[model samples]
Target: MKRVDVAYVLLVDEHEENVLLVKNKGPGASYYTLPGGAVERGETLEEAAIREVKEETGLDVQLGGIFSVGEAFFEERGHHTIFFTFTGKIIGGEINISLPEEIEEVTWMNLQQAEPYIHISNEFEGAIDSKTTVPYMLRDAGRYRS
Candidate 1:
């Protein structure tokens, strides 16, 4: 059976129309994205989001609500990730890049500006434009290959 991992993608507030994004450092370093990580064994998705935000960016964020849920699979990498997208309110903490291994720099971009930088998954693209809360399931075509 394939392993499944749960994670959150946080849209951190930056004033009115903008949100904070983090540039990833390692493998998927080319794209800019939200603060998130895998959900730990004993923690809930919400708890993981809060913990990941603080650990990665040194920011305290109050999760406003869940925006969407989606599955991402990279066949060549042999990984499948389930993502929970959430809207977060920045309550406190200075913007600091704490996780050097996973993140490069932190940036604040308006929602419109962020469109170009985002690595689009059909799930994410739909959620951004839709009014309904949708759960997306993505499967790798090579999931059963050896």
Candidate 2:
């Protein structure tokens, strides 16, 4: 069995037409993605999200609630990642490029505009489009199923 990991976040400024996204740094980095990272040992999923956002963007946020959850499997790497998506509100801090070593750029974009830049995982895309909250699953490199 492959190892599993968790990545979740509180998406700030979601009320606005556009939400913030980050361009990753280093090789194999995707086009753009929400600010989040792997859950650390002994930490809650919510804590991981909060820490990741701060580490990646230097923005402090208050977690609103869980928006969704999904599973993704990286076949080539033999890893299965389960993500908990949460809504968040920006409580403090300004947008500053803090983790330049890990993040290349940060930008706010409308959903439609973000589509092109987002690392297209059907699971993530479906979560954005769904009318009701649902768990989106991505396997290999295909559309979200179930």
Candidate 3:
């Protein structure tokens, strides 16, 4: 099976009550998710996290400690993916959808406001419910990392 690694940044608003999320406009089911993307070759998890946040949201961020890790599998896609999420502090830039083709909107949302829009996954859903930390589900699988 194919293997992939992705990193996401969880950035909270100044009030610490909201998180930055992306509304994607891709094929299949579209949904709002944390700002992040795939880790390119030679890129570390932290580097990917920062880069993805900037690319997706047009916001510069300082990555903090790792909050959680998860894995998923996609039988239809025939791939395996590992996901790592880290805390992030927005250092600059306004909220913008850097890539219009892939991203529809970028916004900060509290858990209650986001629950309906977010696509539920075993890995990150718990993080949203708790509102304080991300959960780790590092198991083998074949899928895209969220």
Residue-wise C-alpha lDDT for candidate 3, range 40-96, written one tens digit per residue: 996667778888998998899987766666788977888799888787799998777
Residue 85 of model 2, lDDT score? 70
| lDDT score for candidate 1 against the true structure | 0.69
Q: Which parts of model 2 have CA positions greater than 4 angstroms off?
A: 10-15, 26-30, 115-146
Sequence-dependent TM-score of model 3:
0.78
The residue-by-residue lDDT of candidate 2 on 1-146, one tens digit each, is 47566665535354656767888875765568788888877666667888888888888987765666667789887888787776677778888888787788878878667655434466567445443444433344432344
lDDT of 2 at 103: 85
Question: What's the candidate order when arranged by decreasing TM-score?
Answer: 3, 2, 1
**Superposition TM-score, candidate 2 onto the true structure:** 0.74
Q: Can you give the TM-score per candidate against the true fold?
A: 0.74, 0.74, 0.78
Model 3, position 130: C-alpha lDDT score? 56
Cα lDDT, model 1, residue 42: 57
Task: Select the stronger candidate by lDDT from 1 and 3.
Answer: 3
Residue-level lDDT tens digits of model 1 in 30-104: 567777878888566777888988887888988766676667787977878777777677888988988787787
The residue ranges of model 3 lying beyond 4 angstroms of the native Cα positions read 113-146
